[model samples]
Target: MSAVPISEHVALVTGGARGLGAHIVRAIAAHGGRVVINYRRSADAAHALADEIGDSALVFGADVTDKDAVGVMIDAAAEHFGAPVTTVVNNALPDYSFNGDGRSHADNLTWTELDAQLRGIVGGALNTIQAALPGMRAAGGGRMINIGTNLVQNPVVPYHDYTAAKAALLALTRTLSHDLGPDGITVNMVSGGLLRTTDASAATPDAVFDAIAAATPLRSVTTPAEFADAVLFFLSPWSRAVTGQNLVVDGGLVKN
Candidate 1:
């Protein structure tokens, strides 16, 4: 069994001011966990979320891609909550639009675009994991959940750069789970399909959403709150023995 209970966890959620990240933070806080809301440019939203969450939440602005900033944020969060952050939700993403027409064609995509996505996905996860390692080791156990996408499996839109980066993140999630298992830190991923209406998916046409819902077994697009509930499972004691796995929470849009 996991040593820590859900109530005792101090969770740090990157890009946790609005959208899916905010929902994840709300889920954690609702379960009695202290939450650290990390944001890069959404300070107002972050502060508002913290205010709404009250004492159980702390707001911090730090770009996850900046190693030093992430390190500092981890330390500060530990001090604020009197416990090191025991749960990390890597939910940040580079500025992206989901509109297929707006996306760069495969032939037109540049290495720069790909690199930028990789940095936000893989690079951010690397920074937070490394910064929180000692704390998780000391806490006896911890949970790490990386937000992923079902597009990695289907890739129906051919978002080459985005899907490629998330694929890399999945690889990192598995390898790190192996590397960190000895420390009692379980790493896993929760992949969702085009969320009903996250900031990134806001640009998606209504027709696209309708098509996705029609294809899914549930006959509906997964909402942010629904996907966040899956993340909560990874943080709970029931998932103590589950790690290095990716659970797709997309209304069965793409079965793994």
Candidate 2:
């Protein structure tokens, strides 16, 4: 696809080192926008991707749960990329934990596990959004897209913690939209079902993949690029009037 005309716009994507996050970074940069790729631990991978993207992309490291670090990351991005970060995508997760581990039964789940999940998905989003608000408001308009999951709608697997965290993120998206709407900031969500073969879903069993594909109306798994395209729509002018909504791009896996 040809690049979108996002020249001079700056975008910040958290957890942008690999998997779906990596696709987002490339997508934004390909569209001619400057991107701040945030990574917590994948320094090498982050730098490598940034290098591959050339000058439009820069990698920064920060623990998204740490407000101070998040602030620093945003500030640095603004200084380096001349932000009013017109776009922000929150796609980071704490760790890759599959619900199919068989150890995730309600009886085995712990507050500690739930807490960590919340911090990564919800807390991280709050931190990044809070940091970007000033610039977005100053710019007169912006887009904030949160990465969610279709599991909340039709959870074939019982990934209680992950789904719960994303549900909370959807709530945050609505609240932020109303809170920032008057300021011309739009907040929305792009939720997806089982995406194929990304690092995040690498642990999913072959049988699980087959079942998900069969269950989907499309009878196939979606790609990370396809999911990224949905996110791009939210960032584009076409979605300027769309906010506080969750757009599911899960190949008809969930009709709602």
Candidate 3:
């Protein structure tokens, strides 16, 4: 639980309709934080989550890659919540999978795939950050959390394009921290390994999970709910002076 109540702040989680984003949204609400659930297409799921979260949760559908839509989302969230959004969790993943069963090898990899990721992750992050900056600045501060992956540090799966984009996002996180800190805003990242079961990782083999668990200090795979909790720390007053840090939450699968 956060020592400082974020109940007055509106926290936005992009792609919050399902997967890890969904869990993150629920956790934010559970901690008494007002939340905005941004979804690209998962309309039904978004609405269901809003109903589950009651009045504290607001659902908005917008493609994160679109600058105009993202701006609209930020404005609507502030209007609906009667306050500027103070925390942003950039968790919207483009079309990518962690199955490892069918992936492009180094020789067969193409720039197109990499471009897609850059467009999705880096582009989306930029669009959202730019759109939300004014409100965050006027409010005197904010927190921006980019959902990263341990694969960049460990390279356990060689998810080339995805890893590359996240690495780029991490760089963005650090640079933004330097730029945004003076405004009393904090920027950081939360990195996780291949999660147990998300739509993207559902095709992953059991043997791989067992191998990961066998080597991890916790002796278990990291769950979405468990990972979601770590995100709150950055938004909490406890991290008042913290910025430009990457918190890895993969049950010790990758130590950095």
lDDT of 2 by residue, 1-256 (tens): 0122466568888989999999988887888879889999999999999999998888899999999999998888888876567788999998855647564778787888788889999999999999988898888778889999988998778888888899999999999899988988889999998888788788778998888889888888888998998888887777777889999998888875
Report the lDDT of model 2 for residue 191: 94
lDDT of 3 by residue, 173-236 (tens): 9999999989888899999987878777787779988999999999999989989989988888
Cα lDDT, all candidates: 0.92, 0.86, 0.89
lDDT of 1 by residue, 17-125 (tens): 9999999999999999999999999999999998998999999999999999999999999999899989999999988777677799967999999999999999999
Greater TM-score among 2 and 3 belongs to 3
Ranking by lDDT: 1, 3, 2
Considering only N, C-alpha and C atoms within 3 Å, which residue pairs clash in candidate 1?
A: none
List clash counts for every candidate, in order.
0, 0, 0
Model 1 vs. true fold: TM: 0.98
TM-score of each: 0.98, 0.94, 0.96
**Evaluation by TM-score, superior candidate among 1 and 3:** 1
